[model samples]
Target: MIQAFYLPNVAQIKKRYENNVQTLLKYPFLFRKDFPDFDSLSVQYFPFDDNGYIPFYKNENRFGSYINVNDPVIDRYFFKNLDKPILASDVYSQYQLEYLNDNVRKSEWVGQENHIYLHYTNWCNFCNFLSCLNFKQLLPDKKIVFLFEEEISRYPIDFKKEFGIDYSQYQVKPIGIREVNRLIWHTQLAAHNGGDFFNEIFYDHPNLLVFKSVMFKNIKEIVKNLRRQWKQRGKLSSRLETELARLRHPTDKDFLVALFLNNACACCDNFRFKNSKLQPYSEQYSERKKRKKRSTQKRNDGISR
Candidate 1:
C-alpha cells in the first residue's frame, strides 16, 4: 500500500533531509514523498517552489501525481539514477527563467481566469481526456483544452469557419501523450537521487506537473480491471486478497485499494510497478491483443473473399 505525504510537513521533512533547505540547499519539489532511507524512493509531484510547499495534485509520477496546487497527489515510486541533483545551474535554457516567468506574467495579465477547471482522478482519465482533446491544453497557459473536446471533427474546416474563436487559437495539435507521462514517472523517481536526472533529460523543457486526478483514475481503473481478469480466468478471487494483506498493512488506503482493485488489475499505466494482486493482467492483455489481431485478420479475409 502506497501512503503518500502530499505536502512537506515536519514528518516528510524528517524523511528527506537531516537539515532544512537552507542547509541542504536541495530545492524541494512539491513534496518529496518517496525519500527511502538517505535518498531513495520519493513520491511523485511537480516542483512548484523548487523549495516550498504546495500539495494536493489529486496523480502521474506518483509525490502522488497531483494538479498544480489543490489537494494531495497520488503516490509515485521512482528512483534516482543520477550522480547529482536535478536543479543545477548549468541546464536551464539560460538561467533567465524567461519561459516560466512569462507564464506567471500571463497568469497575471490574463488574470485569474474564469476558466472551466478540469482535473483527473485517475490515469485513464488522463488517457481519455487527452484522447478527446489531442493534448493542446497541456500547456501552462491553455484556457480551453477541455472545451476543445466538445468539438467533433465532422467538417473541421467548416466548423472552424463557423466558430468565431479562430481555428488558430484552438488548434488541436498532436503529441505523444504516453511518452510525456513516462517522463513524469522517471523525473519523480530521480528526486531521490538528488534531482540531477532532471538536468539530464529536461534541458529544453522544464517539467510542469500534470493534472493528477487523471493518473489516479487511470491507475485505479487498471487495478480494478486486473482483478476482473483474474476472476474470469477462474482463479480464486481470495488469492489476491490474501496477497494484499501480506504486502500492505490494512491501515493503508492505497494498499486497501490495491486489495480491492487487485481483482481487476490489468496493466500498469504511467507507473510501471504493479502490486501482486493484478499479476494476471498481463495474461489477459496478451489474450485480448491476440483476439483483436485475429479479428482484424478475419475482416481482411472477408474483404478478400
Candidate 2:
C-alpha cells in the first residue's frame, strides 16, 4: 500500500493534507498539535507552527518529528503549482514545500531516520510540536535537531552546492531578515532552559543561518559547519552550556521535549544521532529510570490473571 500510494504530486498534495487533517480530527487524542493549514506551506510564518503543538489524534499518538521532504516544493512554487485546499487559505504549505525544495538539492529530500526539518515561521512550530511523540519509542536515543534560518534566499542553489551533501539535510529555510544574528542569539537563550534537547544550540551561523531558523540552521558552509560544531562547542557563553550539563535524564517524560516544547520557542532537547552515527540514548538513563521502564515492560509483557 505504501508503494502504491502515489507520492503526493503537485496536484495531489493539497488533497492529501486535507484528507489527512480530516482523518486526524476523528481522533483528537492522537495528534494534539494544530493541523497545518494548506496556506502555511510556502514559507515560515512566526508563531503559527513554531513547532507542532496542535492536537488531532483518535486515541493518542502525536505525529512525531518532522523531516524536510525533498525539493518539489520549490519547483511547484516557481510554477505557481499548489496542493489542493481545505477551505482555500493562502496555500502556505504548498509554498513552503516549494520553498524547501528550492533550498536543497533533489537528493536530500528523501527521509533520514533522525532529523527535524524546521521552517522559520509557523512551520517551525509544526515541526517543533512533532518532537513530542517519544518517536524514540521504537528507536531509543535517536538524535535529531531543529534545522532553521531565514537567510538562505540570499545564496540560493549554486551557493548550497559548494557546501556539499550535508547541506541538503537543511531544508525549510526562511527568505531573509537583516537582524538574524541577534534574533538567533535571543532564540537560543530562550530555548536553552527548556530541557536537554534545546540544551545544545548549534551556535552555527552558517552563511545560510540567514534563512528561517527552522530550515537553514547549518553553520556557515560545509567545511566551516563541521569545524564550528567541534571546535566551538565549548566557546559559547558558560551560561549556555552550564544548565545543559546538568540535565537529568527524564525524571519523568512530563518534562520531555515532546511534552512542553511548544510552550516556548520549540525544542529538540535530546537528539539521538551525532556525527552520522546513531547513539543509543536509552543507555544514559539512571538505574531507577531503567527499573521503572523495565517494570512497565514487565507489565506489558502480558501475563494477566
Please give, for residues 1-305, the per-residue lDDT of candidate 2 as tens digits: 12333222323434545554554345322223355566554322122143332232323433333333321343332322211101111223433433333333222322222222332434444442332222222112111122234432322222234434353354422111111112233254455566334323532212212112342254234324332342255432343233324555422221222112221211222322222121222344435455877898889877662
Model 1, 1-305: lDDT tens per residue?
Answer: 12433333435444333332222123311112222232222322223543333322233432332232222232321112111111111111211222222222121122122121222233222332111121222234432212122222221122234433332232222111111212233334432675554433332221222222122446556555544553354442464445543653333343334433332232222111111111212455556666978999999999999
lDDT: worst 10-residue window of model 1: 83-92
**Residue 206 lDDT in candidate 1:** 18
Output the lDDT of residue 255, model 2: 22
Q: How do the predictions measure up, each by TM-score?
A: 0.21, 0.17
lDDT score, candidate 1: 0.30
**Model 2 segments more than 4 A misplaced:** 1-73, 76-283, 286-293, 302-305
